[model samples]
Target: YINDVCRTLREEMKRAGIHAEVHAWQKHLASISRKLEYVPRQSNENPLSQLHDLVSFRILVDTDNECYLALGHIHALWRPKDGRIKDFIATPKLNGYQSLHTTVFCLHDCLAEIQIRTHDMQRTATYGIASFWYLKDRMGKEGSPNSWKLSYKEMVTWIEQLRQWQQELPESADEFVEAFKGDVFQDQIFVFTPKGEVKDLPRGSTPLDMAYRIHTDLGDHCAGARIITNMDESGCLVTRQVPLDYELKGGEIVALLTNPAVHPTRDWLHFARTNAARNKIRRYLKTYERESQQADASAPVPGCQTTTMTIHAQDRPGLFRDLTAIFADGGINIGSVSSTVQERSRAIISLSFHLPPSLKETLRALLHQIQALHEIEHVALEPHDDTF
Candidate 1:
């Protein structure tokens, strides 16, 4: 069942273009006796037939959006059981577990549970007894009774990091594990938010990095930060303003400051420590640049919003007067008009006009209006050229 679930999940993810590995596990049933009270494992009749959630699968994608994408694919493949779906991402657990969970009827009427979460959710590491319970649940190994001999926080941090690392690696590694990558979790420092909530970050991480880690919108609008100094006898916080590049020390309470005028520039890439921060800033800048270009394309050219219209029509006596009246009726002001009589009673007339802001978008309709006039053979609005 575990293997089949993994294969099916991977196939669906691949079809949906979601690049994430599915981790699956089955409850290993083994009979053990304290005094033979008759556990379910004691029976050889296969008790799993009566149980749901015997097989479970976990999928970790890059972003919260991808989590839902993968969830949609899973439900489309199998019918989910009613009242069995839980959305912890929208309302996270007390332990801050953010994932979408559902039980589905699958694989020949068997029931399987699926959990979909993003990779970022695991950054909030569990500590103490909670960590021990998690390790036991995932690895099936109970720690020594005196596991507190080492700092519980440090021990569990390493365990969680190691678990995530191991899950991410391929099946084979020719090189020694120590030589593969150095201890990434070792150089981390824990800082505090103004409200005393802890924020774990890498060593030498700046306040700007913390801003981004907290929320992308905060990072985008971040001007600088205020580092907490010692509190007064009244217990009020005393803080000193700091630059974005100021390195945050462990145990310091930092309050991020924002200004609407502030925006991420290329210089942010220089001091931004985390890859997540850098990536978000880059993404925002890219989107901003694209939108600016689109706006510029639609706007009139600065200083000279000159529009030229060329008309080739029959050289009737009232032709010039009728053409002038079109602009007057539409509340347009013609800057200049030039005409030349060509062969066989054909008149080539060119007119230049300055467009107002409100009528900028009506150029197409104006051209259609000119085309509807009598004796109009051909008419065209020339491409905008500032060099003219």
Candidate 2:
């Protein structure tokens, strides 16, 4: 029965213009090493039987861009039910899986689940444990466990970067994974960032997952998020103070904010519901706790309030130096500065400083002057009332 089901699904995928490799396994087979080469070595028997009702399918591609192209192909071949198509290559699963997935009714009342992933992602999913072993075998003596470990670490880092990009762009992490899991893996959702990034999240994921996918720091310091959609031509999707638990949709972008003093709450762990988000929240809390302890050890008094200013500007040759000069000319002691360029053109600068009542006017004037520059868009003043 399972073999027949797998064959039928494979034929259907082919009829729909999707190329898929299918493998079948018998229960309790003896020394089935030959079968192992074709099969994933993991039992997919149930998914085969469940078809579209209980299980889905995923396709692995070669590049991040190809993932979306595959999604377009799937949707084009089979009319996607409203809200059934998802793109998660931009946003990955909590376990660091990335793919594009969808559920569609194929010919002859067969519901099919399709998953699309990059080649690298496909290997990661199928051989989660044996990836390193395979690498070692391929490289012979050079492919030692240590080499595999290094490769694994590099893969993890790449996934982390992708997760961060997904969070910053759109589609909560859970939604991205959910789309992949549900329709493809376990009934998941795939969302895209504003810049066409894909995220695979679980079904019913919230914006908080999006925040964490961007960075642990963003997730830990996350104060709120705004949802923007491609349909919103006026760009009025900036609904502020959005509830973290609000259900997210595909093609919507979420902008996340972080508050320096805000620590991750226990409720966040419950609400987040994704390994990536939960782990990030915990990491933030741990880091914050350690920093608090160190500060307590060094400080004469604790919990002093501080004030900071963040500036956003276009990337120009002298933008950083010019901004720093403004502060220097004002005789303001610079506490710290951090900046990141997005898409290689736009830049965001964050500066922290000790607030002196007398320097308030100087700071205001300096900010005003900076704002007057053609490259500068807006400046935000953040008061660190808890840290004096």
Please tell me which predicted candidate would have the highest TM-score against the true structure: 1
- Highest lDDT among the candidates is held by which one? 1
In candidate 2, where is summed lDDT lowest over 10 consecutive residues?
230-239
**C-alpha local distance difference test of each model:** 0.68, 0.61
lDDT for each residue of candidate 2 in 1-388, tens digit (9 for 90 to 100):
4455556655655675555565433333343333354543347464234324343454544455555665655554554543566654444455656566666555454566666665566777778736745765776666454434544553565356555545633536665564333333444566655565666566667777777766656677777667654333232334444677777765455666567987687788777856657656665677778988866533432333355677777899988888878878997766677888898588988987665666667877887778987699878878632321
Question: What tens-digit string does per-residue lDDT give for candidate 1 at 184-222?
Answer: 422555566777566666667888888986788999999
Q: State every prediction's TM-score relative to the real structure.
A: 0.38, 0.37
Off by over 4 Å in 1: 1-186, 230-238, 306-388
Error of 2 at 304 (Å): 19
Stretches of candidate 2 exceeding 4 Å from the true structure: 1-50, 53-61, 72-99, 105-111, 117-189, 202-204, 220-223, 226-242, 249-270, 275-388
Instruction: State the local distance difference test value for candidate 1.
Output: 0.68
